[model samples]
Target: MRILLASPRGFCAGVNMAIDCLDECVKRFGPNIYVYHEIVHNRYVVDRFTRIGVKFVDHPDDVPVGSILLYSAHGVSPEIRKAARERKLQTIDATCPLVTKVHLEAIKYARDGYNIILIGHEGHDEVIGTMGEAPESITLVETPEDVDQLPFGPDAKLAYLTQTTLSVEEAATVIRRLEERYPGIEHPAKEDICYATTNRQDAIKALIGQVDLLLVLGSQNSSNSRRLQEIGVTTGKAAYLIDGKAELRPEWFEGVNSVLVTAGASAPEVVVEEVLEHLRQTYGATVEDAITREEHVTFPLPKELRVLQAAGA
Candidate 1:
C-alpha cells in the first residue's frame, strides 16, 4: 500500500491556542478548571484531558461558584458569559479568533438594523454562539432551499455571515442563493471561513485523484472533520472518518492500494502517526507527503493567562 499524507492537516492555530489555554489553566488551577465544552471536538483530545482530572461541563451551574471556567474553541453565547459572571466564576474564553470575528460582525450588523443571515448547521456550538450575539437579528439557514423560504424581499437591509468551519462549497451555494434573493445583501469585509479550513480542504482536493481511498482522522461531531469526509464522498471515493488507529478495519483496504491520510484541526498528530504505523505494519505501506501549502499563522495565549504570567501569579 502507498499512503499520501496531507500537509496542514491537524491542529490549526486556533485549536492549538485553545488547547494550550486549557492546559495552562489546568496546570495553574489543578483540574479545578471546568471547560464549558470539549476543548476541541476530538474524542482522544477530550478523553486525554478528562483523564488528567479536568472537568468538562455542559453548563456553568455544574461548576463550583468560584472555580475557573474555560470556554471551548467553538465559543459560547453571551448568555453563558452572563451566567458565569452571575456565579462569579473566573472565566477564560478560548474561542478561535476567527469565530469571534464572526460574532463581532453579527453584533455590528444588528446594531445597524440589518437582518443578518448566518449560513451554518443548526445546534453547532460555533453557530449557536454567533447567533446569540444578536439572536433578534440573526437567521440561520443550512442550504439554498432554506434561503428560498426566507421571508425577506430583495430590498430588505440584509447582511450575511458564516460559521467559521463550514464546507467551502456548501457555504458558496448558500451565499449564491442569498445573493440572488437579496442583491444588496452585505458580506463580511473578509471571508469568515478561517484560512486553516480552506487550506486543509484544498489539500484534500489536490490529493483525491492520486489515491484510491481516504482516511480522515476526527470525531463524529467535529464540523471541520466532517467537511473533509464529505469532500471525499462527493468526489466518489471510499472515505472514512475515524478517531484513530483502533477504528480501522482490514476489509476497507481490500482493494485499496493507495490511500490519502489526513486529520481534522482538532485531531492530534500522535494519532496520525499511529494510523500510519498501523497501515505500514499491516500492508507494508510507503508514505509520501502531499504538500500544497505551508501555514505560519499563530495566535497568542488567552489574555487571562497572559496577565497572570505577566504578574507572576
Candidate 2:
C-alpha cells in the first residue's frame, strides 16, 4: 500500500519553543517548575512533562509567590499577566509569536475604538487570551451564522482578528461574511492564522485525492488536528484523529489501499513514526514523506530561560 504524507505537519514554532523551554527549565531548575497551562495543547506533551515534575496550574494562586511561572504557548490575557505580576511570580512567556501578533492587533484596535470581531472557538485558550486583551471591545464568532448575528453598524470602525489555528476555509467564509455585512471592516495587515496552519492544511488538501484513508495524529481537543480530520472527511475520504499508533483501528484499513498521514502542531514526531511503523507491520505498507511546503520558522527561547542558560544556572 502506498502512503501519502503531509508536509509542515506537527510541531510548529510555538509548540517547539514551549516544549524546549520546559525541557530547559526542568534541567536548570531540577524539575520543580510551574507552568500556567498545558505548555501546549497536546496530551502526550503534557503527560510527558508531568512525569518529570513540571506542574501545570490554571490560576496564578495555584503557583506560589516568587516561583518561576511559565505561561503556555497559547498566550495569556493581559489580566492574567497582571495577576502573575501581583503575585510576584517570575514570568516566562512562552506564547507563540504568531498568537502574540493577534493579541497586539486586538489591543491596537481596541485602543483605536474599533469594535473587534474575533473569529475563533470561544473557549479555546488562544481565543480566550486574545479576547482578554480587550474583553470589552471584542466579540467572538465561530461561524457565518455568528457573523450574521453581529449587532454592529457598518460604519462602526470594525476590525477582525482570528485564532491562529482555525480552518482556513471556515475562516475565509467568516471573513467574507463580515465583509458583506460591514463593507468597511478592516483586516489585520498580516494574516492572523499562522503559516504552519495554512501550510499544513494546504499539504493535506493536496493529498486528499490520492489516499483512501487519512490518519491524523493529535489529541482530540487539538484544534488544528481536528481541522485536518474534517478536511479529509469533508473530501469524501475516511479520516480519524488518533492520539498515537495504539489508537489506530484495524477497521479503518479494511478496504483502504492507500493512507495519508499527518500530525497536529503539538504532536511529537515519535508518534508519527510509531504510527507509520504500525502501518508497515500490519499492512506491509511502503512509506514516503511528501513535501508540500518547506518551513523554517523558529521562535527564540523565553528571556528568563536565556539568561539562566547563559549564567550557567
Candidate 3:
C-alpha cells in the first residue's frame, strides 16, 4: 500500500502561538494557571496541559478572583473580556490574531448599523465568541439554504463575516448564495477563512480522488478538522477522523490500496508520524508527501509573555 501524507498538515501558526503561550505561562506562573477554554481543540494538547496543572474553565466566573487566566486561540468577545476584568483576574490573551480580526470586523459592522450575517456552525466556540460581539446585529447561517431564511429584507443594510476555520469551498458557496439573494450585501475587507484552513482543505482537494481512503488526524470537536473529513466524504471517498493510530481499524484498509493522511491545525506532527509508523508496520505502506502549498506564517507570542521575558532577561 502507498500512503500519501498531506504536506503543511498540523500545527499551523495560530496553534503554535496558543500552545507556546500556555507553555510560557506555565513556566513563569507555575501550575496554578487557568485557561478560559481548551487552548486549542485537540484532546492531546489539552491533556498535556492538564498534566502540567492547567485548569480549563467554560466561564469567566468559574475562575477564582485574582487568579491568572488565559484566553483560548478561538478568540472571546468583548463581553467575556469585561467579565474577566470585573473578576479582577490577571489575564493573558492567547487569541489567534486572525480570529481577533473577525471580531473586529463584527464590531465594525455592528457599529456601522449593518445587519451582520455570520457564516459558520451554530454552536462553534469561534462562532459563539464572534457573535457575542454584536448579538443583536448578527444572524448565524450554516448553509446556502439558511441564507433564504434570514429575517432581514432585501433593503436592509447588511455585511457578512465568517468563522476563521470554515471549509473554503462551503463558505464560498454560501457567500455566492448570499450575494444572489442580497445584491446589496457588503463584504469584509478580506476573506475571513484563515490561511491554514484554506491550505489544508486545498491539499485534501488536491489528493481526494487519487487515494482510496482519507485519514484526518484531529479531535472531533475541531472545526477545521471536521471540515477536512467532510471534504473527503463529499468527494465520495472513504474518510475517517481519528485522534491517532489507536483509532485505526484493519477493516478500514480492506480492499484499499492507497490512503491519504492529513492532520488538523491543532494536531501535533509527532502524532501524525505515529499514525504513519502504524501504517508501515501493519500494511508495509510506502510513504510520500503530497505537497499542495508551502506555508510560512508565524505569529508573535502574547504581549504579556513578551513583557515578562524582557523583564526576566
What TM-score quantifies how close candidate 2 is to the native fold?
0.98
For model 2, the stretches where C-alpha displacement exceeds 4 angstroms are none
Query: Whose lDDT is higher: candidate 1's or candidate 2's?
Result: 1
Question: What tens-digit string does per-residue lDDT give for candidate 3 at 178-207?
Answer: 999899999977899999999999999998
lDDT score, residue 60, model 3? 90
Q: Of 2 and 3, which scores higher on lDDT?
A: 3
lDDT per residue as tens, model 2, 1-313: 8888778899999999999988987877778889987898888899999998889999988988999899999999988899899999988889998899999999999999999999999799999899999999999999999999998877788999999999999999999999999999998889999898898899999988988988999999899999999999899888999999888777788888999999999899999999988888889999888999899999999887888778877
User: What TM-score would every model get versus the actual structure?
Assistant: 0.99, 0.98, 0.98
Query: How well is each residue in 1-313 modelled by candidate 1, as lDDT tens digits?
Result: 9999999899999999999998888888797679998999999999999998999999999999999999999999999999999999999999999888999999999999999999999999999899999999999999999999999887999999998888999999999989988999998889999999999999999999999999999999999999999999999999999999999999999989999999999999999999999999999999999999999999999898999999998
TM-score, predicted candidate 3 vs. hidden true structure: 0.98
**Per-model lDDT:** 0.94, 0.90, 0.93
Q: What lDDT score goes with residue 92 in model 1?
A: 92
